[model samples]
Target: MSLFRKPQPITVIALRDAPDLVTSLRRALETATDAERPGLERALALTEDVAERPDAELRGRWVRRHLDAAGYEGPADSVNAIRVLRQAEPGLTLLQALTYARETAAAENTPL
Candidate 1:
C-alpha cells in the first residue's frame, strides 16, 4: 500500500442557515476596495480547497496567510470580513463559512 493517502474533505454548512454569520461576513468585505478584495477572495478559495481536504494541515496554513493578507487580526476582524461578504453576496458558499471560522480562530488573541 502507498504510504501517502488522500486527505478527507471538510464538511461545511451553508451560510444562509447561519443568518447572523452571513450578516457579519457581508460587513467585513465592505471595508476593502476591489483591488484589496483579492485577499479575501483568496481566503475564500483556500477554504474551498481545505474543505476538499479538511484533514490536511496545509488548510490551516493557507487560512492563516489569507487572514493576515485580508487584514484580519482576530475573530472580531474575521467576523467583520464575513459580514462584508454576506452583504456583497448573500449566496456565498459553505466553504466561505469554514474559511471565515478558521481565519477568525487563528486571528483570535486568546485561545478559542
Candidate 2:
C-alpha cells in the first residue's frame, strides 16, 4: 500500500543520569540572546554549585533542580516525573527526558 518504507527509530544508550553542565551550557550559549547570555554565563561560572548530579544519588535535588528550572512550584513527584519522562520519547537520554518532563509538567500544571 505504500511506496516508501517506514523509518526506523535510532537507538541511543545513556551513559549518565544527568546532563553535562559545561557541554549543555556551551551549546545553549551558541544561540543565546543578549539578555539571556549574562545569566547563562553566570551559571557557567558557577557550574560547581549548579552542576547536574546522579539522580539516584540525589533524587530530591534532581527533582528540585528540574522543577525550579521549569518554574514549577509544587510537591516533588520524582517517581512520576521520571516515569513520564521515560514514556515521553524513546531513545532520549535521561537528561533530555527529564527536561521534557519538567516542561510538560509545568505546561499541564501538574506536579512531576
Per-residue lDDT of candidate 2, residues 76-100 (tens digit): 4455556543554345555555554
Error of model 1, residue 91, in angstroms: 10
lDDT of 2 at 33: 100
Lowest lDDT block of 10, candidate 1: 11-20
Model 2 Cα shift for residue 36 (angstroms): 0.4
The C-alpha TM-scores of every prediction are 0.29, 0.28
Over 1-112, each residue of candidate 1 has an lDDT whose tens digit, in order, gives: 4446553354433222234444444566689798868876665555545445333234344445555666666553356656544444455544564565555455445454
> Cα RMSD (Å) per model?
16.9, 12.5
